[model samples]
Each structure stands twice: as structure tokens, then as C-alpha cells.
Target chain A: MISIKDLSKVYGDNVVYSHFNLDIEEGNVLCILGESGCGKSTLLNILAGLTPCEGDIPKLRTAYVFQEPRLVPNLTVLGNLRLIGADEDAARQMLASVGLDGLASRYPRSLSGGQAQRVALCRAFLFPADLMLLDEPFSSLDLRLKISVMQVFKRLRENKRITALFVTHDVDEALCLADRIVVLGSGGIAGDFSNTPSEKYGGNSPLRERLFALLSGN
Target chain B: MKKYLAENAYNLAASLLAVVAMWLVWIIAYAAVGNDYLVPSFWGTAEEFFSLFAQAFFWQAFAYTLLRTAAAFLISFALGLVAAALGVAFAPFSRFLRPIIAVCRTLPTMAVLLLILVWTSPKTAPIVVTVLVLFPVIYSQLTSSISGVGGELAEMARAYRLTARQKLSKIYLPQIAPVTVAQTGANLSFGIKLTISAEVMAHTYTALGGLMSEAQTYYNLPRLAALTLCAIFAGLIIELIFRLISRYAFAWQRRAEA
Candidate 1:
């Protein structure tokens, strides 16, 4: 289990998190749903060790999928994967898994928005990391592309049994991918719910209604 | 292929038109002055320019001057790159360098040349002065370019835990190469002009500035104009060479943009 205990983070006059505590089970996909400025990204950054926090945070190798693909423009798709120590065959295999096959030699400029994000997903899975920290990785995609890319992400995450903390403001995204969903509010986690197989597929289940109410209240 | 050829032809014509316009201005100025000593006729300067190609001493001086400019440029480029890299790595060092760069930028060229000539040999003074003047410019350019390497990309690299070598080769270098190459062309051209001015101030013999000084003393207006023209031509040639190199070296950048 990855644990964050008594995590305190401040930025100038703004107090983002104070003595926040959370425990994540191994191989569990925890989706953090929150409105803007609710410290969702800060929590992920703390977990990824990108932000300094005063707490006992576990040291684990992390793979990050940012809002933007963040691929090196000059590097080919495979080359970007290779940058983080992915071997040729593993990178190629991972690319194929994300439906980016035959684009190993293509640069990021050539890839469409959805395609680039898929490569980013491929890169995250290819890395030998204990945890994956995704910061609204699909926020920029249109609905059609978002669904397509989410499907790709779901397939890869299940195949790898990735322990990921997905941060998003989209309730549908949280329901579809998250094994457990936590809604971050001004105070702390305002709502927590387990996403069973039945609730995961339901379009407007009681759980979804509850989450929407919790989010709107926060 | 046809479009490429047509584009090249148009560029060539545009360049020629500019040259012709300059020649016309020079002709007009010469006619108005009607004094060979002040503004030599275009043909007179052209004759002297062509005659310079036949002189062994002129060629030797030309070669020496070119060598000095090139040496100054290379040294300044290397030093600027190292300093910029250091500045990027350490914030305090960057702060420290800010004042030094300001001093270099604002130093009086003639005073610095005089001080350098007293401290070093005349032959070396011009190169030293040129380096001092050019280093800060190059350093500023490089610092901005290196810093401009996207913050997002850097964060991604750090999150991935890429090794230092991998980060440098895969991220820093590629991101900065195209901009650096483009700026280098302008920097080298400016370096040549500075070197020549320093050489004249230092009274360095066996150099283009020395030849210009000799021509001025003899009141050979045509030769002086020819020497000035030669320096301009050298600057143009250096700029063109570097521009071509940048185009060839970073073709992928263009392709990506396209």
C-alpha cells in the first residue's frame, strides 16, 4: 500500500493541503474527482514527488501522464518511450497496445491530439514504475476522442494492473476507470465510493447521483 | 521541383535588386560629392576591389583578419555556452552573471581596446576585445534559448527519472539546437565587425584594419572603400554559410512546422 500521512503543503499565502492523510491499496485505480483549485493536481504532484510536501510520503518510482502529452517534439514516438528506459521491443509492443502501431518513427507533431495522448499512455505503462500519476490526461480531448482514448487507457491499465491515481473533474471519467473514487473538497475528501462492476456501467446510478450532489455541494 | 526553382530564382532576383539599389545610391553620392577623397566613384572602388585580389600582402592581411575573427567567435561561443549552462543549473550563479554581462555589454569599446592593447600584444588585443564584446551577446542568446526549453517537457523528464546524460542529449540539445544555430549566424557577423574595429583601434598590422589604416594615411580613398567593402562581403558570406548550415542541420524542425 502507498500511504500519504500528515501531508501539509503551502504555496505562499495559500494553504493547499493541511495534515491530509490517505492510503491507496496496491493495484487499485483511485480516481480523484474535484473542482478547479480543490488541490487535486497538488495531491498527485505530491505523490509523484514533483511537489514538496511536509509529510510521510512513500518513495516510489512514478509514471506521469500530464494534461498535455508532453512528448519531446523532436523525438519520434518510440524515441520518447525509449527516453525513459523503454527498450525497442517493449516500446513497440506498448505502442501497439495503445493502437499506435506503425507510428514508431513518427514525431509528435504528426500525431493528432488523441493519438499523442495515447502515446503518452503507452509511455506511462512502458515505464518500470510502481505508481502512475495522471493529471487530467484526457481533459483536452473532445467527447468522441475522449471515449476512444479512455477505452485505450482502460485496456492498457487492466493489462498491466497499473496502480494509478487518476485526477479529473469529469464524473463520467471517474466512474468508468476508477476502482474507487474520492471527491476532493475545500476541507478534504468530501465523498468516497467504491465503483462495483454494476455501478461502473450504469449511466445514471444512485452512486453517480450522489457523487454529483457531493461535487455540487462542495 | 519547379516551385523550388521558382522560389530560388525569386530570392536571387530580390538580392540582386538590393545590390543594384545600393550601387545606385553610391553612384549618386559620388556624383554629388564629386570628390574622390570623400566618396570614391563606384567604378573606382570596384577597380581597387578587383586589384586587391592580385596583391599578396592584401591576401595575407585578409587571411589573418579572417583567422582572428574566427578565433574570437569560437572562443566566445564556447565560453558563452559553458557560462549559460552553469547559469541555467544554478540560480545564484545566474544572478552573479547578470551584472557581469551588463558590464560587458556597456563597456566603452575604445577604452576597453586601449586597456587590452596595453595588457596584451597588439596582435592579441583585437581578439580579446572582440571576445569581451561578443561573449555577453552570445551568452544572453544561449541562456534565453536554453531556458526556453519547455517547462512541461522538463517536468516530464524529471517525472520519468531520466538520467542527466539522457536529458541533455534527448531534451536540452535538440530543443536548443535550431535557435542556437540561427542566432550564431548573426553573432558571427557582428563578431567580424567588432574584430575589425578593434584591430583598427589597436593599430594591429598585418590585418584588414591595418590595411585600412594604411590606405587612410596614404589618402587612397579607393583602397579604403575597397577594404570596407571586403569586410562587408566577409560578413555577408559568414551569415550565408551559417544560415545554410542551420537550414540543413534542423530540417526536421521545418518539416514539423510544415
Candidate 2:
């Protein structure tokens, strides 16, 4: 239900994206995979209308999770969610779903990095949005934390069926969370593939090998 | 609870020790000077302090000075907060107002007091001078704290689409509150002291400073010492009250640290 065409972004003699185009279907989890500085986050910001860019984006209410949790440091976890209009009960329930149930009254400074990211996830899920944009949301997580958070994302998507555009560089992260993965090269889409985790093979899977090779610049 | 009581008891002991040390120095000086006009004995000042408690005039003067302090503080604090908010919200306006605020901050208190005395009524001079002296303190503290709010957090607030009220109460207010409380607590005593100094010069009626001036004219060193102690106590009390408020207001912060 979302499409971008001829989107361009420039910052003082540096061009990040030139005539880039992308499309995301309704209720699909699309992960835009890219290396650092390849405009994965810029694309998300353009979609969120946070960055000034030449593009046409759908006027949809979108919730965003930055690379940092960006939780208000002075507010309790519940208060941060409430800042986005979540009632105590709904916020508590979502916090529970994300394994942060009893941390509602805790301030952001007291939380571990992984727990804080989970709170950000809970925030995005708690706020009913037409589309959720996550920018490298799991880049800081360890393997165990990453798996746990990815599971939470999977569960939230399964339950809500919300359209989400996830921006990240990790190939494994995209494979775990995305229904369709689009690899973002320097200027635009370089590799786009349909991903179904249950049906995809292990070890020598052609799709996985291709993705790994593309990421390693083979 | 035991620990809390122990801490209070320790504080009381320390204060008593300090008071004893002060009395020892006072006695030594009194011995050396041997003149009540120049250096009053500790017992003489103590007598004056007790006598002043029963005198209605002394209480009236004390009340008058305290009321003036409260008025000056409220006016300065309110206007300072408003100015700081305006400065933070509008950059061009802040730039326009910066030199004026800087003048207030850097100008000598006595000079500002003299200017106010010349331009304003003596009755209002102390309050006006207090504001001129203290407003910059509150303004700078607030503006700096507000500016310290990170851009990333602002972006987060926008992404969440928080209402203006929500953004303030939830984010900006909380972020600045600790610093505001600290600045207010530290400056309040100084503001009150400046108010008294202005009052002495302005000849504001029924104020502690006017009483002090009268004592000085009469060469009543014991009464002057008693009055000075009273002023110090009043300042201590104000600082204590603000400390209590800061403690209660930031109890959540304490909890997080714990």
C-alpha cells in the first residue's frame, strides 16, 4: 500500500539517494537491508517525513523506532508510552508481552540496552499506526537479545498484521523478521527477494548464500 | 528508619560543634577588644536575640523583610521562567534579548540598586533590584537546561506525535526540573541577602535591613550581631525548605540511582 518513485536526497554536495524507487505491499514486513551510509535510515526518515527530501510518500500515521531507544530519560517506561497516548493498562500489557512487565515504573536510565530497545518496540506496537518504521532497531543487541527482540517483533506482526518497514544491515536479522527483504545498494534497490523462514533451507540454501554473497560484495 | 535518624543525629551533632567553635572565637575576640560597641560578648548577643523574640517590632520587621523576599523571589522566578521559555522557543527573540540578559547578569548589584533607587519608588526598589539581580540566574539556568535537551529525543517526540502539552510535561519539564530546583535553591539565599542590602539603601520601612541600619547608627553591636544571626537563620530555613521540596520532587530520580 506504499510506493516511492524518483525519491532523491542530498546534503550539501553529498548525494545519498538519487532517483531511488521502492514499493511495500499492505500488511507485509519489508526489511531494507544495507551497509552503513547506504541511505537505509535516510529512506526511512523520508518515509516518516522527518527528513526533507524530494519524494511522494503516503500521508499515513507512522510510528518509528530509531537505532537508539530514544526513550525519554526522565520518564518512566510507562510514562514514555503514555506520552504517545498509551493508557496504563495497554502499556503495561505490551510491556509484559515484550518481557518488561514489571519495569513500567522504572526510568529509562535504569534499563539495560536490550530492555530499553524492547521498550521502544513496545512503544511502536502499543501505538496503533498505519505503518511502523524501524531504523536499525536491533543493531546494538547481542545474539540472545536479538533473538528475543526478533521474536517479539514476529509475534507483534503476527497478531497485528501491521505494515512495517524495517531498516537494518544485518542479513540474518532481515531473514528472521521480514516477509520480503530488499537489499539497498548505493543508489537504489540492488537485490529484492521473497523470504519465508519455515520453507527456506539451511547451510547451503541458495537464497541465503546469495544474500550473504551480495552483502559481502561477491 | 534507624539510618535516617542516625543521619539526622549526626548532622545535629556537627552543627552543635560548629556553633561551639564559633562561640570560642567570639569570646576570644571579645576578650581582645574589651568593648561592647566593637565586639559584643556571646552572652550579650544571646540576650538580645531572646529579647528581640518577645518584641513585636522585631517580629514585624522580620515579617516585612520575609514578605519582601517572597514577593521579589516569586516575581523574579515567574518572569525568569517565562523569559527562558520564550528564549528557548524563539531563537531570534533569544538573540535579541541576550545582551540585555547579559547586562543584568554582569552588572554590579550595588549599581543596579542605585539605578533602581533613582528611577523607582523606595517601596518597590528592593523588589525591583532583587529581580534585576536574580532573574539572570534563573534565566541562564533554565535556558541552558532547555538547550541541553538532545535533538534525538526531540525527533522521538515528533515521531510519537506528542501534543505540545505532552511534550512539555513529559519531556522538557522533567528534563529541566532537577537543574531548576538546584539553581533556585542555591540562588534563593543570595537573592534574599541582596534584597536586604537594597532595603538598607532604599530605606524600605519595617525591614530587617532598616533595623540593622538603626542598630548600626545607635552603636548597638549586640543587637546588630543578634539581627545578623537572625538573617542567617532565615536564609538557612529558606534553603532547607527548598531542599525538602527538591528531595520530594526528585524522589523518583533517587530511586533510579539506588
Candidate 3:
């Protein structure tokens, strides 16, 4: 579990967030949605302790998948995996999980943007962290890759209580991946819409148009 | 294969032409000056080159100079790596050490040579000079490499609970190896030059710098030309070796380049 209370940050004259409070539970995926320059990524950085924050973040280790893959270009696929302290076999397994089994000896520069993102995703998941902070992890991925990686996460969350904070600009992505979609606007946590609507709803509760209408009308 | 050869053939030809043009200029200048004592003709210098290459004394000096350069590089390399590791692992230490590196790197080379000369033997002066000249190069390179190893990747490492040694050997070292190789090329080439320059001043026994200094003192033009050629050849060889190392060490460079 992680908690943020009344977190505030300013740059010169602009306020990023003020009196901001958030709490996350283990095993559930929480998606933070906002446009560019709206401090979504900055919020993630503060949680990861990359930014100096007025509020406290949990002491437990959290894996962050940055907007950029941020992989060392000189390192091979296996080398990148080894960075997270994964064994050689574990590295191979993770790569295979991401459909990168043939590119073990390959470097980041050799990989396409999608493949690089997959490697980054695999790296974060392979690392044993209490929380995984994903900032647009699949933003560069094509349709098929996106769906596949989402399935990978779905499979992962089944047996493991692996908490995640998946950040994205896309409303659909928030719906597809997150268990609880926290609609963040200029009002950050404007609405807490549960995508996992039970029984007859079968998880894909409200349609995109209906959700967009609710967000706009509000 | 054809594309590769076609791309590189132009560079080879251009380099060849440059060498030929330089040789022609040397011939013309030497002949026009008509002063064998001051500047020997092309053929005369070429003969001396062959003669020096065959001499055991020249080889001994060359071996001594190489060993000294290697020692200086190894010393600076180890120190630079340790300093960089410390700087990266601790921000406060990096802040403390950065200014010292900037000052050392920017200090006058000739002044450093003079200071070391006063404190050490003629032979040992070259070693000290080589270290001082090379320290900044390796240190700055290593620091930049380490600093560029971003916090996001480091957090990923932390998430996995990687041991300190694993973090260093697996993550830190590979990230820095390419940059270190690049700096090694630059520093080693400079190291060879610095060692030779120091040798000229100190008149260290069995160094090409010593040979050049002796040539200058006695007005031995052919010997001077031969020794200058020797330095160029040695510097070129060292740079080529580093070039090879960079290619193998950083495959990502090749991948991006292709």
C-alpha cells in the first residue's frame, strides 16, 4: 500500500498540484489520466523519489516504466534484463514473454520503439517490486503489441498481488488495463469509475461515448 | 559487401592521397632548403627511419616509453573509475570532486610538466606528466557516463533488490564501457604524445623524445625526422587499437550507425 497526502509542487510561478491526496492498494491497477503538461508524469516521479516532494512516499521499492524506455543503449536485451538482477534464464524467460526471444543479444538501439517498450515493460515486471509505476508504458506500442502486453499484465495480476499505477492519456487504455480507473482532469481525481462492473457487465461496463459524455457534462 | 567496400574505399583513397601529398611537400621543402643538417631530404630521412627501426637501442627506448605510457594509463584508469563510481553513488561527493576535476583538466599542460620535472627524475617526470594529463580525461569521461546513467534505470535496479556489486558490475560498468573506450582512445593518444613531450624536456634515457632532443641539440636532421615519424606511427597505432576496441565494446554504436 502507498499513500500521498496534501502533496504540492510549484515551478517558478505555476502550481503542479496542491493539497493533492491519493491512496493505492496492493494488487489493483490504478490509472491516472491527464493531458500533456498536466503533471501526470511529474506525480509519478515524485512517488519514485526522483523529485523532491514536500509529502512522504512509501519506503518500499517501486519499479517505474518511464515514458521513454530509458534502457542503456550499449546493453543487449539480456544485459538490460540483468540490470534488474534477473538471472540469465530469467532474462531469457522475460524476453520470451514479450516475444523478444530471438533478440537476446541485441542492444536497445537495434530494437524498434515497440520492442524497446516491451523490453522496458518486461524489465519492470521481472523486477520484484511492491509497486510498478507505469508512465505511458505502451504509448509507442502498436495495436497488437498493446493488447498482448495488456494480456501479459492480466496474466501477471491473476496470481500475484502486484500493485500498479498505470498512467496514460488515452481513456480507452485506462479502461482496458486498470481495475479502478481514477479519471484525473484539471480536477485530478474527478471521478472514481470502476471498470470491473460485476455480473452481467463483465468488466467492460460503460462505453467510450457514455464515459466521455459523463466527463464533459461534469 | 560491395556497399560496405564502396563506402569505405573513398576514405582509404583520400587518406592515401593525403599521405602522398605530405610526402611530396616534405621532398620539395627539404630539397629547396638544401640544408641536410637542418632538414634532411626525403630519401635521407627514409634511410634513417629504416636504420632506427632496425636498431636495438631504438626498440629499447620504444619499449620503455610504451611501458611507461601503459603504467600511467592504468593508474589513471583505475583512479578515474573509482572516483566516478563514488561520484555516481553519492551526489555530495560528486559536487565536492567536480571542481577539482575541472581545474586539473583545464590547467596548463606545460606548467604541470615543469612542476613535476622539479620534483622527480627525468625518466619519472614522463610518468607523472602522463598521469596528470590523462587523469582529467578519464575522470571527466567517467563522470559524464555515470551521471548519464539515469535515475529511472537505477530505480528499476532497486526494485529488484540488486546487491551493490550486481548494481555496479551488471548495470554501471556496461553503461560506462563505451564512453570509457571513447575516452581511452582520446586519452591514450594524448598519453603517448604527453610522454614523448615529457621525454624531450627531461631527456629520459631510451625514449623517442630523448632521441628528438638529441637530434635538435646536435642538428641531426635525419634523426629528428626519423623520431618524429616514430611518434606519429606510434600514436596512429594506439588510436587504431582503441578504434577496434570501441567497435567491439559498443555494438549499439554500430547498430545506430548502420
TM-score per model over all chains: 0.94, 0.91, 0.85
lDDT per residue (tens digit) for residues B1-258 in model 3: 687679899898999999999999998888788889766888877899999978998999988988888889999999888888788779898899878888877878767778888888888889888888788778778888988887766865654566788777767787777767766777778888899988998888898888889889998888898888888888887888887797675667676633
| Recovered native contacts, candidate 1 | 0.57
The local lDDT score (0 to 100) that residue A2 gets in candidate 3 is 78
lDDT of 3 at B38: 64
- Candidate 2, superposed: residue stretches over 4 Å from native: A198-205, B4-25, B255-258
Q: Please identify which of the two predictions, 2 or 3, would achieve the higher lDDT against the true structure.
A: 2
Q: Pick the candidate with the highest lDDT.
A: 1
lDDT of 3 by residue, A1-218 (tens): 57888888877788888788988877788888766777888888787666776765576677878777878666788887777767999889777766789988888888887778778878877778778899888777777767666666665556456788988877677777777877666755767766651222123445555556645644
- What lDDT does model 3 reach? 0.78
Residues A1-218, candidate 1: write the lDDT tens digits: 88889999999989889999888888999999999998999988888878888989999899999999999988988888888888999999888887788888888888889999999999999888899999999999998898889888878966888888999998888888888999998888898889852324338878789989999993
* Predicted chain B of candidate 1, TM-score versus the true chain B: 0.94
DockQ-derived CAPRI band for the predicted complex in model 1: medium
